[model samples]
Target: MSTKTPTEDDILRPIKNTTSKWFVLFGIAGLAFGLFLIGWAYQLMYGLEVTGLSDWGSGGGVTWGLYIGAFIWWVGIAHGGIILSAAVRLLGMERYMPVARMAELLTIGGLSAAGFYIIVHMGRPDRMVTSVLGHYHITVHNSPLVWDVTVITAYFVLTATYLGLTLRYDISRMREDLPSHFSPVYSALTYGYTEEEDEVIERMVWWVAAAIIIMAPLLLHGGVIPWLFALLPTYPAWFGGIQGPVFLSIALTSAISGVIIISAAFTRAYNWDHIITEDVFRGLLLWLGFFCLMFVWFQLQRIITGSFFAGISGTYATQAMLSSVIYVGALAAVMAVLIFIFAQALRPSLFTKTRALVAAVFVLGATLFEKTFFVVEGFQTVEFSIYEGVPGPYFPSLIEMSSVLGTIGMVTIIFLLVSKVVPVVELHAVEHLQEGHEPEQEAPQEVEA
Candidate 1:
């Protein structure tokens, strides 16, 4: 077994030469992000008044449904990255080593996207500062939002610190001859630093990994999604107890897929030799397959539960999911995810570059749509006394759409910019291979290279 490590020169190559496709991608991302900013500014100046939201129905133009749905999706992606980082570090799995840094980057990026959406979703964005800085005693009855915001912030800080420290260490390894600061302040931030060696970094990685593995899931499943869905009495048929678990599964799946797709795109655009091999993709597919199994079972539970008690609205929301138009979209999306996974698992070789990219995009879209059903569809059915017999229809206006696009555009821009400056794959993986676990080789000899 040989890990063909990329040299410092190879790592530095992308940074030095940004004149080609890199610039183009960044330019597009930037322009889209600028558009988002302008749109958001327009919304802010005119208020939700410029949009379709009415004072009549306790409405802002933006639907909390879409924002919350996307928030969960992004949170899932973030958790997936955290899990990837943690798994690699904990197990010392050399195969996952290449993607550790990549995974961490996704975590930060996805979380940032979710956080921004939270702000835009709010009718009162100005209170965000007060929400963060103001103090209150923690109690079960108190605002879960307070606690959620706190935990999420802490998780972000920890992950960012871990990546920053590791990146600095990677820099030192790639250019040991160069002068760099290791003052007391910097070392403290690096969490009690030592020599910038592969093994040392791995051990440091172990600590960060353990922390992420523990914290991210807690913040996401235990904290965020559950906090939203738990309050509702009228959970749709599709949303069984399995929603949280399934949410976790899809989150990890999408997060990993996003990382893989982004990394592959980076390789193609930059022609970086450090791009992940087929074995990595195969591993990703395997993980995707596992998620597929869970998702399939989750769907089956919904359908069976719904079928068993047809027309039963109060107790079982499953019936609603099976028969509803919204669930039609949700079910189709779920089926697409399953078919994609089955295609990946049954005859793995068929997933070529183009197919894998297609599959990845499909799965992400399906998962996002599924989330839409989970959030928006159920909210419409809640038998609140105030609503009487009339049902709510969540039709997001252009203002909301613009906000959503802006957030996504911002996230894409951030990712593109980061890919240019940061090493997308972990340098430590290469170093570990060079340390005699696997003999080094050139491209012509590698499988799935």
Candidate 2:
């Protein structure tokens, strides 16, 4: 590692500099999102029929397809990011402090994408106010969808509070160095700033972290996203206790994989190799391996329960999953990455940043396919074909496909714009890494790693 001392300039480079690369990326993302909006407009004008979703009974096919699948996937990714960030604070995983801000930002972006999918799938934006929000009192009693909305909204508020409290201290100390144009924003964020409140803010953050840890795994809140499907007893594929652990594992894997990809990108783009070092990557990859293993095991648990011990419907869903080339390919991809990660852990010399990035991309893609398939496959019939082959297999329409790319672009834009405004790396992160200050290491964790 280089011996260069950390400074304000190191963290401020992203704000002070706006290079051609940033412009190019922003333009590409904008184009993708713009196309998605055009597609969305077309969808709104025509109706949900343009997307090829159909009724479940005699009408044939499943009503929930790419949009709902993607919704859960994005929500899981969002919840998982906050979960990781919360663990960092609660467990005092200081090695990951540099990434706490990134995870918080990811949660916001992912949640925005997830919430937007609801509007897209609903086909009318006003329905959010009229249908969900206006009548939430009646729906809140029984509708899992409403529960998801409520808890996700609560999650957003909690995350904003957590991030905002952390930001006050950082912004106040570096007010002079941050861009002058954003002064009003900073002023609002730090309006009541004082040195005395620092301790209180830390305690508040700690308690929020504790609350998240408790709530996330329950049948409500973050876990409610999966519970939306799991509670439907008619669908054997979706109904199970295993879904909580399975989805959480996939979520954690997806979130950490995203962090790996983003951490590497920022490190290389800004030349902060010393700050986000090899050790960080190594630790992240190992944790990823552990979670990936859990993902596979939980997946196995679902498959076994569905395939052997269940009714005809469950078996049919299992059969469909096993037979589908896309489904098998997704599992294979995850397995391949898991094997590589395990091998690298044993043979340290085999590890490389490029390889780690590849593993992350593989897991991300695999999880997306797996979740989308899980939702779609859950609706397929096990008893008999009601349509007698009249209705074709459910596939995402062109518009649906575009929505996926578009939402991804939207998230990219969110991160790109936010980097220009806030310091993506916390000021505390730099202080921890400054010369002559070695972070305290907990020896027990080393052996576990």
TM agreement with the true structure for every prediction: 0.84, 0.94
* Model 2 Cα lDDT, one tens digit per residue, 183-239: 999999999899999999999999998887787777433367777777778777788
Total clashes for model 2: 0
Worst window of 10 by summed lDDT in candidate 2 = 382-391
Clashes in candidate 1: how many?
5
Clashing pairs in 1: 1-438, 2-438, 2-439, 237-317, 237-318
User: Over all chains combined, what TM-score does candidate 2 have?
Assistant: 0.94
What TM-score does prediction 1 earn? Answer: 0.84
Regions more than 4 Å wrong, model 1: 1-5, 49-63, 138-141, 176-201, 234-240, 314-316, 324-326, 435-449
